[model samples]
Target: METSASSPSVSDTPPGHTRIFLVVVDDTEEMRAALAFACRRARATDGRVALLRVIEPSELQHFAFIGKIVEHETREQAEQMLQRMAAEVNRRSGHLPSLHVRQGKPVDELLALVREDPGISVLVLAAGRGKEGPGPLVTACGAGLGSRLRIPVTIVPAGMSEEEIERLA
Candidate 1:
């Protein structure tokens, strides 16, 4: 990739190159497929991909009164999960991809990473569940993340089949 002093955004192309992708990963199946799709798209477009995983703050402390009823993964556990997910993505891509792990709110980390790295031209995210549950209802939190980010974001809905996902790839 080439960097120019005049531009605010970083270009993924190395003068003559054409494409690049940035995918944000989470512990969901949908997230996995989205990353795959992004990789596939990048491959088709002759671009490179960056796989990032953000660890959200623990929700356990808020509901400590419930006492073990709500089982949440630790940050380390989440990191492990992210590694597995990254491995899966790498397998499909047939290359060792760039991986990033950060601690903070998901949206905040994602946006900050994008701002810090100009190579990331697109953001791929899994569509989160709504209060009613299932099938892509608009959640304020999810919507806020998409709206706040400077780059374009593609939200992969939950429960998508591999075949369905491959089409996007």
Candidate 2:
């Protein structure tokens, strides 16, 4: 499916059931820990997963064509990545994962997604396990003392095995 500004989700929800979705912010890495965690939660709750990938804005604003091309490529990449992740979720949890591609700031786009789609139950992220600190998205969402997200945020730490993630979810 062609991705729009707010890309449509590839849903596999039961016809009558309202889908309660867990929105996981997909970044540079696979973040397998978070994916497994979200899938398990979705399976147990009879919901689904939405893998969201945001393309950070480029500094190249001189020409509109460059921005469009970049966005197109980014969307294609996100779709392929989400397809692989969806297969993994289906294999692990028997649920088809949905793909949501957006542009601009991660936190802002996430909040916009929340505002646009009430089906989203929670936002999941992986804590940066480096000396650098909790990842930008986590920190941007006010990870520590001041959590700003209206919806609950789940931050899975690094080194969590799939089994541990399964247990946590």
Candidate closest to the true structure, highest lDDT: 2
- The TM-scores of all predictions, comma-separated, are 0.65, 0.79
Give candidate 1 regions above 4 Å deviation. Answer: 1-18, 58-79, 128-142
TM-score of candidate 2 relative to the true fold: 0.79
Q: Candidate 2, clashing residue pairs? A: none
**What is the C-alpha lDDT profile of model 1 across 1-169, one tens digit per residue?**
1112221223434423534466766545456667767777766676656766666555666677553343234544555665675566556765445566676766567678777776677776565454445322124335575576566766667666678877763
lDDT of each residue in 1-169, candidate 2, tens digit only: 2242232353333333544445555663436677777787878877677777777776667778997787678778877877777678778767666667777777777777766666666777777677767678767767442254556777777767877877764
Quantify how close model 2 is to the true structure by its C-alpha RMSD in Å.
4.0
For all candidates in order, the CA lDDT equals 0.58, 0.66
Q: Which ten residues in a row have the lowest lDDT in candidate 2?
A: 1-10
Please report how far candidate 1 places residue 7 from its true position, in Å: 26
